[model samples]
Target chain A: MDSMMMGAMSKDMMSMPGMEMMDMSIMQACMDACSACEQACTVCSTQMMSCAPACMNCADMCNTMMRAMMRMQGMTPAAMMAMLDACIAMCQVAMDECMEHADHSEVCKMCAQACQACMDACMSMKNTMMSMS
Target chain B: MDSMMMGAMSKDMMSMPGMEMMDMSIMQACMDACSACEQACTVCSTQMMSCAPACMNCADMCNTMMRAMMRMQGMTPAAMMAMLDACIAMCQVAMDECMEHADHSEVCKMCAQACQACMDACMSMKNTMMSMS
Candidate 1:
């Protein structure tokens, strides 16, 4: 997330064959949202709510999605779209589960919001991919 | 990766609406592979190989992919495919980076192998999805 890291990532992304068309800003936002959501979900999962499993799962998905964006050279457009869909699906599930505990726990509420934001970011990425396609 | 956790995950994966179409055994194997690869990549990244950045990225992606499978209710088939594609992309990047150091570091060699195995498992899952489709 630091400038140096972003510089490294940006340089890498720019060099990818098809990714020359990508909007780095959008990708950066998505990765940032995912990192925040993963942190929130990880903390929320340890709270032992019924939502724990879903939160745990969401944490993992967000982290994976973030890393995938960072390593775009390995992907095709189809693959990127598939990943976005999956990340959105996982966030939706986690958000629904966490919302159930929102009134009882502040962490659950915060985590659910993070999941929602991550879902939105991923949706944006998906739309970007579609437009590019 | 304990039995209790596996039981928790298996029970959740089994109850999803259309996920009964999913093969939990194969899914389980993939998750286990991701977890192992993440651990290996994490340790390898801290070793400061030129491959460090890629290893760090792979570590994050494998963790996310593992967690996503643990939360299947969040996903549709399309989403699952996308996630697998992203994961495969990330793993390929990590494997290629680590392969450069394979002769100098046993850990890199092992991590590369794990990435290869994970890629194979993911490809198998993709093939299964295609067959199911």
Candidate 2:
């Protein structure tokens, strides 16, 4: 998301209890990571490898996690934490599955990297939430 | 998804410990509904209504829920149930929010209907899962 969208999200998030501490910089990085991960996973899924199912699952979770950040008004902190955990778990699974064939396929290698980035971003979000709370 | 893709998903799902009872027809309908809902919500979000955030959230959840069904190998029944519940909740929130301005906007009206349809499809999936379990 761009700065303008983040600005809008900031306003929306301010209304939610305990969401005031949400750092837009961290969220921006997280959203960007999620978006990139989703794209990589989407492309990797089309390859029809054994890891395709995991890639597809990770793509969807990353997209959902990104949008959830954009729509903070619709989420409770508990729900947000649950979703971040889900995203992190999905990214991990996708990364592991993708890494199995990474040496044979450059796309799988790129996907694994993207999944790692997303997992790291999500964990950052989780840590931020915990520290803020 | 095409029948071939569904067939592949069906085969993958059969390998899951307790997913043998999953019905392809219901899953197909639910995936269609999720896709439609995502499209409608994407359009609705651009309108910048107070409900835009909810619409975006619903769209993401629907997409995630759809892909989750396609990737049953990546999920436990418990995770699937949690995602379904989350999708249903997001859809309800979006539908309720969109209905408030439905009379003023045709897109919102259509989005609301799509959300309702997606919610119903998800519920049908839930019912099937419960019965099979």
Score each candidate by Cα lDDT. 0.80, 0.85
The candidates' interface RMSDs, in order, read 3.9, 2.5
Report the alpha-carbon TM-score of model 2 versus the true structure. Answer: 0.72
Name the lDDT value of residue B56 in candidate 1. 76
Local lDDT at A3 for model 2 = 90
Candidate 2, CAPRI quality class derived from DockQ: acceptable
Question: Tens-digit lDDT track for model 1 on B78-112?
Answer: 66776788778778878988899899999999999
Fnat by candidate, in order:
0.46, 0.38
Can you write out model 1's per-residue Cα lDDT over A18-65, one digit (the tens) per residue?
Answer: 677778778888999999999998999889888877777777778777
Model 2 regions more than 4 Å off: A1-18, A46-48, A71-82, A102-110, A130-133, B1-17, B71-79, B102-110, B130-133
Let me know the DockQ for model 1.
0.33
All candidates: CA RMSD (Å): 4.6, 4.1
Candidate 2 per-residue lDDT, tens place, B10-109, comes to: 8877778887777879989999999999999999999989888888888888878887887777665566666777777778888988999999999999
Residue A70 displacement in candidate 2 (angstroms): 3.5
Per-residue lDDT of model 2, residues A39-126, tens digit only: 9999999998988988888888888888788778766566677678778778888898899999999999999999999989989998
Give, for candidate 1 chain B, the lowest lDDT window spanning 10 residues.
B70-79
Colliding pairs, model 2: none
